[model samples]
Target: MQLKNAALYLLSLSLLALAGAITYFAASLRDINSSLPQIIDTVEKVNQNIAPLVAEAADIKKQIPAILKESEQIRVSINETIKEAEKLNSQLPVALTESKNWRILVPIIVKEAELARETLNSGIQEINLVRQEIPVSITRVESLITESRNIGKETSEGAVAGVFSGALRAPFELIAGIGNSVFSIFKSEEIILDNSDKEMILETVQALINASEFGKTTAWKNPATTRSGEITLVNATTIKKARCFNFLFKFNDQKPHSENVSTILCETEQGSLEVVR
Candidate 1:
């Protein structure tokens, strides 16, 4: 019985220790259960951050080929620019010389253009002056030509009259001697046909009176045709500041008849005939 008690005590002690350890384990398990929601929230936050980083890494990987291509193009462009700069340096001296030459000629070109414009303006003015004067000059020339024609016509007429007067002079001299003594013979019924013949016959009779006898004897007598009495001229004198002659005709014209006539004439102070009576 004592041994059975002792075994039973030992079993009860072991069971008490076991119960205490189980109680401690149960309290630790309660604490673990209480912190499990915070741990899960931390793990979920860490997974959320890792998922974005993974997506960004994938996007960077996708763009790598385009980035490399752009880098290569930039290198090629830089090389081409360096080569163009080298070429420009080689041609720089000649380009500067051409620019200097153009600068030197610019003033000369501008002066030549100004001179050309002035010369053209002068030529245009000269042309306008000529145009304005041409019609006036033509009109003056036409007036001169007309005046010359009129002068020539007058000269021709004067020459013809002079020739005609000279032609009648010789024939007039032949009849002058007989006409002075015989001019009053014709009657109104006689064969007097032409007025020019009557004038010629009368002028021949008057020419028979010598100019030397003007103041001494103013009398003139002429034989009559088919009449018994003679024709006479008297009063050969100056009157009214003019030379005049008076005529007396007495003859048989179907009967004894008498007529009187007067003529006015002009003469120079020297007694030379100026105008016919």
Candidate 2:
């Protein structure tokens, strides 16, 4: 009987160990089941994020050709920019020099502009005054010219009783009226009569006067200039009671050169004044 009781106790111990192992395995399986939904949710989130990244990567791949083309264009543009920059660098110094020269001239240009403005203003007033005076001056000149013509007519017809016996009055009106210069040959100085229309000098020619009656010196000049010359007649009579007179003269203008000349005047049988030499 005692042996049978020992066998029952060992059998009970084996049954309890088997039951504890089964219960532990059941608890571990329950914990794994509870965590499965959270793991599945994490996996779903990872898939959702990864799907957009994949789509974006594919789109980027599609854009690669256009990006490469743009990059090539940008490289060409950079090369062109470099070339243009180099050209500008080469030309920059000359451009800078021109700009500097313009800068230097600015003050002078402004000053000249101001001076021109002043000159123009003054010139307008002067021009108005000149306009007013010109007509009166012209009228006086015309009257003087008419008077000179009459004087020339009277002088050319004047006959000397002793020397000019058969003298016909020769009118030197052209020579006299042109210059409008009344040159009394006995005067000390005279202005040269210039004919502006003909661009010729009007020289006065008169019959030789008695040497003692006229002065031995005369001066001549242009109307516009002060430069003048004097001629001194040293000898006037060539022969006693001769029809022709020879005059010796020494002349000087301001120049270093001087001239000594012998001039002959003949009273023709018709009583006209003639220069022989």
Candidate 3:
């Protein structure tokens, strides 16, 4: 009876241990069932992310031949560029030699340029000097002309008066009177201009010569002297490498006397108009 009691106790202990193991296994199964949804979601996300990678890999496979062809073209271009560089390198020595030869002429070219500059400066100085001297020269010329006119007039009047007085003393008063009357009738009318009148006339002439067209006339009057003058541009020419023009000047004095004179004026290197003839 003791042996049967021991066997029954051992069987009850085995059943209790088996029941505990079944309960633990059932709880583990429940936990696994709850995490199944998360595992499935992680798998779906991995597939979605890998889909584009697979497509890109296929595209790279398809472009491999074109990429290889383009690489071959780049290699050919690089080789051509290298060949051109070699050609330029080969010619560099000849270019350097030619440049050295050109360097030998640099001093000579600079010397010639300096000489040209000096010549230009000298010409400019000469022009300036001429320009400064123009007014003085004009005044001198006018003075000389006035002196000559006065001398001629004095000489003519003295000779005529002496002849008339000698004829009257020789008992030919009637003849002298007739000769004087004839001389008076045939004597040329003179238009005497003062210095102020001359200056006004010259200024007008210069302005007209510079600004007036051909066949145009410009006139000036001096109120102080009641003197008037007109200058007309008639013809244009070149003389001694200077631009020249012919002008006709008509002068009127206070008296009923007038005179016409034709003169030629030329432009000097100084750019001033001067009487040429």
Candidate 4:
């Protein structure tokens, strides 16, 4: 009975050891399985994060041509702005010169010419008055000489030779002397009229010469001017334009010297007169 009890006790101990080993292996296997799933989940999350980063990098590479095109446009716009500024800068000197001439010189020259022309017209009026008076004086002198000749012919020598010798001869001689004196006066005055006409013509010619010289001189000295000068923009988008210079008067040679000169001078040329004088 003792031997049978020892063998059953050993069998019981073996079965207990087998049950503990099986429980430990089952727990260890469960732990290993849970750890493997956690590792796989971590790898999947890493792949998701890395995929977005790669896609963003690819997108940035694709946009490079558009960015470069925008940069080139900006450079071209900057160059165009610089060229426009340079064109404006080049016109500054011309604008400044024009301003100086217009403000100070042009008006003053015009006023001076106007005053000179007024004085010339006044002189012309006086000359015309003197010229008209000369013809009337010449006509009166001629009529008086004709009357004296007719009276001397009517008084004959045959009917009144001895009867008209002393007293009549004295009266006739005195009459003849008076007529001769009148003719001498007419001749002298005719010469004076010719001289006066020549002198007046010369004086008027001088005035014309003076006016023409003044016009030429003024044109040379004070040229037509612009307040702002022309600006030329060289860029592709820029537009071109034209400008006109400012002038107080037309500066035509055909026009009269002034309004006053036109009234006095029949023709605009030098030495031109209305009457023979």
TM-score versus the correct structure, for each prediction: 0.34, 0.37, 0.37, 0.22
Per-model lDDT:
0.55, 0.55, 0.67, 0.44
Q: Candidate 4 clash total?
A: 0
Q: Clashing residue pairs in candidate 1, if any?
A: 181-223, 185-225
Model 3, position 142, has a per-residue lDDT of 62
Q: In terms of lDDT, which candidate is strongest?
A: 3
Candidate 4 or 2, higher lDDT: 2
Error of 4 at 227 (Å): 68
For model 4, where is the 10-residue window of minimal lDDT? 230-239
Q: Tens-digit lDDT track for model 3 on 1-277? A: 9999999999999999999999999999899899999999999999998999999999999999999999999999999999999999999999999999889989899999999999999999999999999999677556544543443355445543342233222211112122222122212447555667766765665555433345789889999988887888785665775556677877777787777777776655544456656
In model 1, how large is the Cα lDDT of residue 60? 100
Cα deviation in Å at residue 136, candidate 2? 15
- Error (Å) of candidate 2 at residue 101 is 1.7
lDDT of 3 at 226: 88
By summed lDDT, the worst window of 10 consecutive residues in model 1 runs over 163-172
lDDT of 3 at 95: 99
Model 2, 1-277: lDDT tens digits are 8999999998899899999999999999899899999999999999999999999999999999999999999999999999999999999999999999999999999999999999999999999999999999677556545544443354433332222222112222223332222222323342232243122222312322321223455555544533344444332332334444445544343445455556565544444434555
Score residue 178 of candidate 1 by CA lDDT.
38
lDDT of 2: 0.55
For the record, the alpha-carbon RMSD of candidate 2 to the native fold, in angstroms, is 16.3
